[model samples]
Target chain A: MNILYTKNISKSYGDFWALKDINIEVPKQSIFGLLGPNGAGKTTLIRIITQIIFADTGKVHFDGREINEEDVRKMGYLPEERGLYKKMKVGEHLIYLARLKGLSRNDALTKIKYWLNKFQITDWTDKKIEDLSKGMQQKIQFIATIIHDPSLIILDEPFSGFDPINVNIIKDEILKLKNKGATIIFSTHRMESVEELCDHIALINKSNVILYGSKQDIKQNHRSNTYTVDYIGEFRNTNGQFQITDQSETEEGYIRSNIRITNDQSPNELLSILIDEVEVHAFQEKIPTMNDIFISKVNEGTNA
Target chain B: MHNIFLIIQREYITRVRKKSFLIMSIVGPLLIASLWVVPIWLSTRETDQKTIEILDDSGFFKDEFIETSSLKFEYIQTDLVEAKTEVLSSENYGLLYIPRINLDEPEGITFFSGKNPSIEVIQDLEWAMKSVVEDIKLERSSIDQATLDSLKADIDIDMINMTESGEKAGSAGVATIIGYISALMIYFFIFVYGIQILRGVIEEKSSRIVEVIVSSVKPFHLMMGKILGVGAVGLTQYIIWLVLSIMITTGISSYFNIDRKDSLPVQTEQSGVIEEEQENEFVAEMFNSLESIDFSLLAFAFLLYFIGAYLLYGSLFAAIGSAVDNDADAQQFQLPVTIPLIFSLIVLTAILREPDGNLAFWLSMIPLFSPVIMMMRIPFGVPYWEIGLSLTLLIAGFVFTTWIASRIYRIGILMHGSKVNYRILGKWLFMKN
Candidate 1:
């Protein structure tokens, strides 16, 4: 079931259309990767869903009903340009933000303490935000985002200012939250994280979603009907089953050749032809990475 | 509503705990108290007496100078040069030279001193010589001094204002002073608290915390919270100053045994019993006029106008702050917003000249100028309906400005790194969130 979704949402700023007829659905308890280049209307769409902004002509649904101000309490958003009050203490800042999301004071305080201890930053509670390191502040901001135990959490470029260790820590926390039945919408340009963490992705470019689906399905659909084979013997020819697109000699005296099926032939048929002529050491099909798909789709959009 | 309350709490607590606020709160009352205390202290304190030597060439001015506690006159038998040298050599204040001249044309009289003599001393010597000359002229014209004295009359008019209740004594002078002071206070508070709202908004926007905040609460809530919070801070400071000033003034006055009647500079020996009696009467009349003012009504109107004016301007200032990236960029927008306030202050004297004139009436009805102009007119006794109309218009204007400001603020806070102008701000007001 979908936790949140937008249907034909469009927003414009005077003569500029920041978003246009955008449609996206985030399934329950899934890590949905909102992948896009910079200024691809990703932030605008997130703002619309958070109800910080309104779409000109469309509907945003939270659960089964149209979203309202009260429904926003169930959703937590960490904007790309997120910040905390520099003069405010960590504990106080968290409590304030939690309370703003409709948590009672006691509940806010209790949740703040739990989150701070869980993140192992309980000692930094009294420290002002400006005194903390960037990564530590990012951790505090992360705690503020999820302190209310929101059902749907949206994090935009959450790993921008963190070290690798902190990045992994946040990643683990994100996965833990999803395992706890919270849907996550993660927006980033980092393709590698999308590959490792996201279950579903919707790639938007130039105010439009160009590609979207489950990670496995998107990779499956972008396959080029090509395969790479490693052989130790001299590579001769295929028996009219496939065509060798490229060939290279490995440093260890092995031949690596890229082959594409020519006549609707299966991989088994190509392998039988290759086994007759060459010693087949290893064979694998080539699948596109999210990075490759993102670049190509954005290029296609600009060209169109 | 709860979110707005939270925002206001944060804004108020953070600012009130600031070091600058504490310093201003403590220092502001001392400054105001000194304004009341210093003048009376200076006037009652003793001054060093000065002696002047008189060289009379005409020989008609001998024994004409009279001595007072602060000044002493001595007659010297010497030439003008010799008298000046003696006066300079001794510890005397100056030398008064009455050159040989006709009594009808007294033009060559001069006072030579090492430094400039105080105006009071010069006026005293001139009066002494002129009185003697006038006595001689009166005798030569065959007129008696008693008859001349009877011809001189001092006129004092008592103003009586007829109200619904009855006739009450009024003083235009006292009303003008009270009106002017209250208007100035309103002007001062609006600027001070208005800028505070602007800076608060700028801080939230520049720090980029507004996005996280607006995602949870509406931008209108945040803006209203900030404006109200800062205004409460201003009110807190004002009340503290008022209490502190009254306490200090009364404490110092009682300790020094200073009475308003005694604080008046009464030079009995120099001015004689007639002028002293008149001075006493003037002070008594002023106290009576003070009692005629309706302080409760004035206080109520002051609070209403002050808050109404502040909210109106405070919202505009917040809008300006949201449009700009920093204080430097706020200058272009601030000028237009503050122009009406400055204009009212500039025309304050004109309004006071005729409180019921057409200029004052029209300006008092306009929401922007009414806070000041209407305040200045209130002490002079404005019709109740006129004040009601002005107040209604002011509230409507406040509501209108707040609506405009909130619209601009919601969009402006999210936009960054763009050069904003009035045209862009107008576009933002109509743009969808």
Candidate 2:
């Protein structure tokens, strides 16, 4: 089921459209990547979903119902412009934010202790946010965002200030949250992470959604019908049926060529033809990475 | 409602626990107590007697200077040069030379002191010289000295306020002091605590925590929570100061018996019995002057105006805070908010001068200035209808400002990095989103 979706949502600042005719669906128990370049209204769409801002011309639904104030209690948002009260104690700040999301004092305290231990930050509970390093503060901010056990979590650039190890830790946590049936909307400029994590994604550019779908489907739709073949042969080209984009001979006397076939050819047909000509060691279709798709689609948008 | 309360709790607890708040609460009363007690104590303290060397080159002025407990006159038969040398060599506190001159003119008298003489010494010297010169003039004109001496009585004016009902003694001096002080205190708290609301909002915005909190609670709630929280803190500090100052003032005042000698002037060469009688009457008048004010009504009006004025200004301050990116940016908006506060303060002197004048009446009726201007006018017996109207307007002002502020607040807190001019803020106020 679609846990959250925006129907024709649009937002504008004076004459500048921050988000325009944006529609997205976040499936339940899925890690949905919200991919966009800078100034692409990714943050604006996330804000609208979290209700930090109201969409100028559409409706946002949570669990197939129109979003309301109570939906905020069930939703969590970690904004890209992160902040905590620098003068406030780490534990107090967390508990306060937790209680604000409708947890009782005791519940907030108990949850705070659990998260502190999970982050290995129990010792830093009494320290102020200013005293913590940037990575540690980001961890605390993450805990603050999700401390109330929100079912729908939205993180905007959550990995910005984290170290590689801490990034893995947070990625593990995001996966763990998905396993526990939480719907997550992850927004970032890091396309490689999106390729590894997102089951679905929507690419937005210039306040408009240029591409969106399940990860596999989007890659397939943008596929160029190209394949790389690794074979040992005294090579001869196929005459006008397939196009060799690149050819290189390995040091072990093996020839590797990237070939794109015409519309009439299939991978199996090329594989059978290659087998008859040379001993084919390996052959695979080259699926485009999210990084390539994001760049190409964004460039396509800017050009158009 | 609950979220607003929680926010208030957070704001209040953090501020009240600050070391600066504790220090100010304790040190403020001590400062106020010292301000009132020190001058009274200094006047009553005993000082070493100082003798003045007087050379009467005008022989007619011999034995003219009187000896008081703190100052002594020692007549010397010496030339002016010798007297000056003696004074320089510490023979006396200073030298007073009455040079040879016609009593009618008396132009050549000189007082030489190493440092600036105290005001008391100067006044005494002038008094003695004037009395002596006048007596001599009267004697030369063939008037009886005894009659002139008896006619040297001081004139006292007992001012009365004549109402339609009867004549009642006026307490202008005491009323002015009370009125001016209360007006200034209201102005001070509103300015101080109003900025606190501004700074608190700026802190939340600059730190970027506003979005996090805004997600949980409406921005209106957050603004109201902060404004009320800071106002409560201000009220707490004010009450503590009030109670402490009163305790310290009364404690020190009675211990020093400051009321007695400070109120009565020293009567020169009067009979002991008559001086004692006049001192008692003066102390009685002081008590009567204090009792003339309606303390309960003054306190009630003071608190009502204090809260009204603070809430009104506090909301505007919060709006300015949300509109700006930082404290420096707040300066552009601050001037407009503070103009009314400062204007009321500038008009305070005029209110004290004429509490019943049309300027005071109209200014006191204005909601922005009423908190202070009306406070000053209250001590001078303002009409009840004016006070009621002023309060009604103040309440309406607070409500209207809160509405306007919250409208801006709802949008401004989430906005980042935009240069916010007054026009932008005006648009935000009316913006539906």
Top candidate, metric DockQ:
1
Q: Can you write out model 2's per-residue Cα lDDT over A1-304, one digit (the tens) per residue?
A: 9999889998988889998898888899999999889988887787777776788899999988999989999988898887898889998999889988999999999999998898887999899889999999999989998898899999998999999999999999999998998989999989889989999999899999889899999998988898999999854655768888889998588998988887677899888888888999889998788888988898887788
* Positional deviation of residue B248's Cα in model 2 after best superposition, in angstroms: 4.0
Residue lDDT tens for model 1, A271-291: 887898888999999778899
Off by over 4 Å in 2: A229-240, A243-258, A268-282, B53-64, B74-102, B105-122, B145-168, B250-260, B263-286
Give model 2's DockQ, 2 decimals: 0.68
Instruction: Give lDDT tens digits, candidate 2, residues B313-390.
Output: 999999999988999999988998899989988887787778899999889778888998988888777777888999
Tell me, by lDDT, which candidate is best. 1
- lDDT (tens digit, per residue) of candidate 1 on B1-433: 9989998888889889899988998899889988888887886664457899888889888877766656788888877787887787899999988889898998788899988999988888887787889988997898988888887787889988777877788899999999999999999999998999888888899988898888899999999999999988898899889898899999999988987775667654445466568778879888877767778889999999999999999999999999998999999999999999999999999998999999999999898999999889988888889989999999999999999999999988888999998889989988877
Off by over 4 Å in 1: A229-259, A268-282, B46-48, B51-69, B72-119, B262-269
Name the lDDT of candidate 2: 0.86
Clashing pairs in model 1? Answer: A54-B433
